[model samples]
Target: MSENHTSTASTPSAPRKKHRNLAQGVVADISEQIQNEILKPGDKLPTESEIMRIQGVSRTVVREAISHMQAAKLVETRHGIGTFVLEPPPAQAFGIDPDTVITMRDVLAILELRISLETEAAYLAASRRNEQQLQELRAALDALLNHTPEDGDAISPDVHFHLLIAQTSGNRYFYDILHQLGTNIIPRSRINAAKMTHDDPAAYLERVNHEHEDIFNAILREDPEAARAAMRTHLSNSRERLRRIQESNEIKSSSDNTRQ
Candidate 1:
């Protein structure tokens, strides 16, 4: 009698993009390009081949990122032509158009959006998240905490942690919009503002992570009210952090002018 033997070796897969920067990472990279005026409105975006080369992500990843940018009104594609940066139309009302988020004030405006949406998301996540998702959230947070300076900022895992919470909310809109905002939603990722403002950036990050812990614990205990409160506190603190940075910069500039 012949017996079938199971293979002990796992099937090998293609090497992942370093750190799995993925579609969101591509969005962030291209968004930064737009923010810095490297690719101005009406300018044609680089071809997929070029984007793939620059971002070290796959062509499919590039396409996915571009789709999100289109959803955000940051870019437009003409079939058989190419994608182009969009000139934002005049705001008909007071609402954020993510493309216009170039200044610190703009960032604060979007952070307000995050505060409103994510607070509710946390409450829902606490009430609805499954055991597997809870484990994923914990894993994402731990990755952020353990991320090394050598691999660059903790933005990837930081974004992942929040994305997981939104995913756990069981509402696709929350996940979709947050994914559309991507890393651009994070102030530190947007401007590296923390490093410039905080006397000790490490300590500041530790404090932020402490707040994350509070939120995580609330969800772990299935305390919806506490989860909402914890999210509010963390996001509110981010706003205050930015305000303080702005004030400190202004004061320093005034001092320099006086000395001169």
Candidate 2:
């Protein structure tokens, strides 16, 4: 009788790894072109061969790059129609829009919107929060205390704390909207906060902490009006900072225009 021995080595497959920057470059370059209007919405991009030639890269590289752009919703590729630029939908339309513009005015507008929606949200949350919600809020506060920097650094517990409050509000939609806004809100808030209170770290944090304490106290008391007032004060501070930044930027731009 003849017996055959099989080895696992012959069938072993190598783990696949992604190329970190090449694909990123492709996506970023294409997205920038779209945002700059070089590639408008509905404008079809060149074929794979054309891109490979222009980028001086392999077909695999081109494909991988295009895939990233598609995933970011910056472009769409049809089966036989090739890829076309995608229009940026409104904020909160879906996932991150690659074409979204970042400016001081834009940041200020977003802050204003948050002031209106989130104040009402806090009011409702104060009335509706249960013991579990209160516990979550306290936990978030603990995390903030642990993470808040004594000196000026980039660390922020703001996003997670607000997210916790939104979840504790008992409205799934509030959580969803908060999640969507998370990406856009944080950077803007950080900029505004930093610009507003760059003078004194201790003072800034004390003021912010007091605002938080007032809001939490209202929630504990189940006083919707007080909760709303606290949130309004917190967001108003943000808006005031953004206004200063916008004014500064406009002045700088005007000076540059004259110098030119």
Candidate 3:
């Protein structure tokens, strides 16, 4: 009997992985096109049939991939209006961060910027807030009426309170800016506040409540200068606390990465 040797070729199963990969690739391609402004906001995405034709994928795969992007807030689907890009990509939900690299000084600078905007916001809020706005502001404050330092609440209420003030300033632009920046600012401020409160509960609470009361009084009196000043003092304390935090983080990061 003669020895026989056989060589087998790879089967169609190898391409199965490629199919799933191709589906993901299609999703990414669509997302990039939209983000690049090649597909403008409010422009309807191509229909399912059209996408299938363009991507050379089956109907089910195309729909599944598009469904994933919609869930990610990158796109929205209307019953009859078709899929369109959401406006401004929802605050904190999307952005390109060129300035994500942070230094101790940069952190302090952000806090300083907050001081300027918020103080003016308080001043304008005092004289400009209308009945509805006041009601909303009070509602927001009431959400934190008795918040204790130990109680880990008031985060959302605090944010809404500031947003109300910004809106009441009668500058939609200010409101939008605050809405965008607030997402980043509030949590950092809260973390810094928690650290300070943990260190000296009584003093921290006393100072915070007193400054808040002063801001409230200024708003009630409609004294723009006092409102601004009170807000400045409040934000200044916050700025100092964050600066301390940045220094601490720098020290910690330095120690961790130190070579033995």
Candidate 4:
């Protein structure tokens, strides 16, 4: 031990610290460009090599920078495609980080958020959706209907159906929030609560599809009031199912804690 020496310059932590600084430098430059509108919303960021050249950073640093940008919500990276700048959230924008919505309670909170946001969206969609959008909605509906109940992975159609409603609502903010939320908005996708709570998950999903059909028919009829009512009932049914599961969980947790 008396003869041992470890050089800080060669330590792994030293290289990591250097890389973090370089990454932060890249993140700052790109963030400034976005804030200044130099990199506007929907505009794709440069290739990773381009960024490496411009920032004089390593590939690892550039990738780290992009990850930081995404975490800040300044950009969204589409796999196999480039990262694009996102429209900045407004000062009053109500946002929920999808990564944090892990628990059933978190999903229930999201349902409440949807109840307020989507009921109105459904009404607006019914009143204002064009023929093209309506057809798109039909295509989305059929996708949902065709999802084999044997598979529990129904996220794609479920998300598409709700996103179509938001897009059809003629409100960009509605679409923005829902799009930002993405597949995470579907609670069953996240937690598989239906499978846990229902004796027949397939039948539960079938009934869920029927609820979707009701909402679609209301929209097809262009009955705004009916659309709003259908949307409310659909969401309320989900809320009730989740509430039951959550209640059961709470009781079990309380019993376990008491025993402990």
The numbered model that scores best in TM-score is 4
lDDT of each: 0.83, 0.73, 0.73, 0.86
lDDT of 2 by residue, 1-260 (tens): 12323344433432223455666677777888988999999999999999878877678878989888887888889998889988887785444442464666666766776777788788888989999889888777766555444444433466666776677677777777767675555454464365454546556666677777788888889999999999899879867866876787788889999999
Cα TM-score of candidate 4: 0.62
Task: TM-score for candidate 3, please give it.
Answer: 0.54
Query: Distance (Å) between predicted and true CA of 112, model 1?
Result: 1.0
Every model's TM-score: 0.59, 0.57, 0.54, 0.62
* RMSD in order of candidates: 25.1, 20.3, 11.6, 12.0
Candidate 3: regions farther than 4 A off: 1-105, 196-198, 201-203, 248-260
- Score residue 213 of candidate 3 by CA lDDT: 71
lDDT of 4 by residue, 46-153 (tens): 999999899888898999999998999999999999899999987876667677877788888888888888999999999999999999999999999998766556
Quality of model 1 by C-alpha lDDT? 0.83
lDDT of 1 by residue, 1-260 (tens): 12323232322323344324588888998899898999999999999999999988778889989999999999999999999999876766333456667766767777888899999999999999999999999998898777655567567787888989999999988988887565655534344656767546677678888999999999999999999999999989988888777788789999999999
> For candidate 3, what is the lDDT?
0.73
lDDT of 3 by residue, 206-229 (tens): 676677778777777778899899
By TM-score, the better pick of 1 and 4 is 4
Tell me how many clashing residue pairs each candidate has: 0, 0, 0, 0
